[model samples]
Target: MSVIQILIINAVLVSIAMVVLWLVSLRLKDASIVDIFWGLGFVLIAWMTMAVATQDLRSILLVAMTTIWGVRLAAYLAWRNHGKGEDSRYAAMRDHRGGSFWWVSLVTVFGLQGAVMWLISLPIQVGSCETVPMSLPNYAGLIVWAIGFLFESVGDFQLARFKSKAENNGKVMDRGLWRYTRHPNYFGNSLIWWGIFWVSASSSTLWLAISPILMTFLLLKVSGVALLEKSLANRSGEYRDYICRTSAFFPWPPARRHGSKLV
Candidate 1:
């Protein structure tokens, strides 16, 4: 299939998926479930491309890496959010929309997400359509992806464990991966897309470069750092200190010892 054709088809698929989810949200009365499906949305697009597009080692690799990243994220979110009521963000949106929340959510939450996920999946769509022999970029991309996968997986694990501890209640997390950065998971997520871009891109496929760029922007500027900090800002003196010392996105060495003040 041609690139444009694949894009058109996947756009429709994504729209339909979101509509279905909207219906499910209505039944469950929780738009937060959409967060759990965010990763799976990309997984659907990747595998759909793999199934219909011409297959090559590179395409297969893209699908494999995407599945590894997507499935784990979705499952982890499901587990973490289990029994939790609607996420504050979505609940706020629902409250803001009043009686129109169903349609409002259809347009704002599910529809907007489907649109962005489709844009991000451009690499998988473009990359999987072309056949090529594996090269250095491919292997290099895999290595980078592995690094990101570990950071995301391990970082999430560390944070979850810290939060589960009774003594850590209301405390700022600054251990393990969090010690290096305030948002190791977001950093790892950015790396994952960039690494996938490396695997999928060539001179001809360079147009797909925006995939990782958009994902990085959304993570750093929009949903990831900006939104998260609003809640974390007033949590404690320890968190403020952690923010002072720890990098926001990229993993870096702490600028000061925990609980230390700057001179």
Candidate 2:
């Protein structure tokens, strides 16, 4: 099949899976489970694309990076939400809306996430669809993707540990990786897709250009970074204080502005 055909097929199939899973979530009353599924679902799409590969190293590398990220994120989210009740975000929305919540979840939550997933998968879509052979740029892209993968993995580990620690329980995480950025995980995630896009850019397709830019936009402006941070901001007073000294997205040293109001 042609590259565009492959992407559209993947998007449709993934969207259908999300819809089915979401309906199941309504029955089970859990949306956090969807988050895990979403991550693992990307892995499925990436490998499906890889299976159709034509001896391209870029395709192989992209598949590997995406699989690594997807598996890690799925495992972490699944473990974290293991015994916890339904995600409070969804629970609050459901309670506030009452009976129409099923419809609300369909369009606003599950459908929205599925769209974001498709947008983020642009790199993989582009890589799978490209007709050109890999080159130096592709190798560089793989390096960049590896960096993002490591950063995200380590940042998640650090934050998870901070949260689990006795003294830091229910406190804002402001040490180690978290000290450098308010949302290291988001930063890493943004980098990963951009790297993938760069690899895919070897194709010279204008439509495919939307992939990295869209990923960056979402990480910075929409559901990935903004929504996650906003929720945390409301949940933790210390988060505001952490935000004051640390960078918002990029990993950078603190400004060292002492005696300033954290809020």
Candidate 3:
């Protein structure tokens, strides 16, 4: 199978999976499970791409890197989302749309997400399909992946800890990574894929063209930072104040708000 064919196959499979999940969600009355499936779906896509590609050093390296990323990410997201109810974003959509939610969600939510997933996976597909040897770019990709992984893991841990504490319950978390960026976890996630794309850019294919850009757009404009921050900004007063000081999607030194002292 050619690289393009492999990508199409991966996209179709994930789309079908999402459609099935959407149908099930309509019956089960929850959508958090979709989050778990989304993560796992990417792992499956990466592996499938590797399997389809002709055996070569590049293919092997791509598989190894992607598997490490996909597996860890899937596990973390699944563990975090376990037993949680529907994500607020979907729930809000359901509430607003009412009975029309079934169709709306199937096409707009599930289908759209499936397409984006495929777009974001383009770098992995391109990287894995081509033959290339170990090089500086590959090493750089690993370093970027490691840094992104740490940021994501640490950000998640800090937020989880804050939520678990009694006194901190329902409060905006402004310590640790959260103090620097409103969505450090998301920032890390975005960086990781860009790193993956950079590694893959060594490939003959130019498929990395869409991967990093799509991921960033999704993180900033679509579902990642925008949706979550919108909800937080509405619910938490401290969140608004934090936003005034902290960067939205990148970690940086907190800037002082008018009349507010920097900590």
Candidate 4:
């Protein structure tokens, strides 16, 4: 099969999966399930590519990387969302759409997410399909991916643990990775996709750089930082102070936030 054909097939498969999950979400009355499926969608594409593409080191590497990242994220999200009901974003949409939400979610939520998943998996598509030895860029991509993995996994773990504590309630999380950046997991997620892009970087597939750039944008503006902060900003004044002192997206040495004195 040609690369284009394989990519087309991957998109079709994910689209079908999303449609099916959308139906399931309708039955469960919980749109948040789609978040758990997001990771699995990429896993499906990687495995589907592995099936069609020739077995080689490049293919194996891509599959391994996607599999580890995808499955870990899927499991974590599934666990975290247990008994949480629908996510606020979807709940608000449901409230807005009311009786029309079922079909609306199928197109706006499921179909849209499926397309984005396929778009972001461009690195896997290019790398797994191409036959090449591991190069410097590939090695660097692997190292960068490892760093991202640590940052994402540790950040999520720290946040979860902090939330599990009772005393920390109503307090801003300024410990561990949160102390550095407001969204370490989101930063790490952006880095992971960029690392994947670099892994597959070649004269032919350089155009696929859009994949990582899109992921970075989504993390920063769409679902990761801007979306989360809308509610968090309403917390205590300490959170506002944290926002003032800490970097918004990137990790750096935190500076003290000053208040106007005797104005």
TM-score of each: 0.96, 0.89, 0.88, 0.96
Off by over 4 Å in 1: 257-263
- Candidate 3 residues lying further than 4 Å off, grouped into runs, are 203-207, 256-263
Global Cα lDDT for candidate 2: 0.79
- Prediction 4 TM-score vs. true: 0.96
**Regions of model 4 farther than 4 Å from truth:** 257-263
Q: Can you rank all candidates by TM-score, best first?
A: 1, 4, 2, 3
Q: Candidate 4 has which clashing residue pairs, if any?
A: none
- lDDT tens string, model 2, 1-263? 67777777888878888889988998898866778887788898888777765537667777887888899989988888889889888899989989998888888888888887877787787677677777777778777777888778889899888778798767777888788888788888877876777777674654666777777787789767788878888988777767777999989898675466432
Best by TM-score: 1
Residue 68 lDDT, candidate 1, scale 0-100: 92
lDDT string, candidate 3, 47-131, tens digits: 7887787767666666776677667777877777777778877889889999898888888877877887887888777777666
Global lDDT of each candidate: 0.89, 0.79, 0.78, 0.87
lDDT, candidate 4, at 238: 75
Pitting candidate 1 against candidate 4, the one with the higher TM-score is: 1
Residue pairs with colliding backbones in model 1 are none
Q: Using lDDT, rank the candidates from best to worst.
A: 1, 4, 2, 3
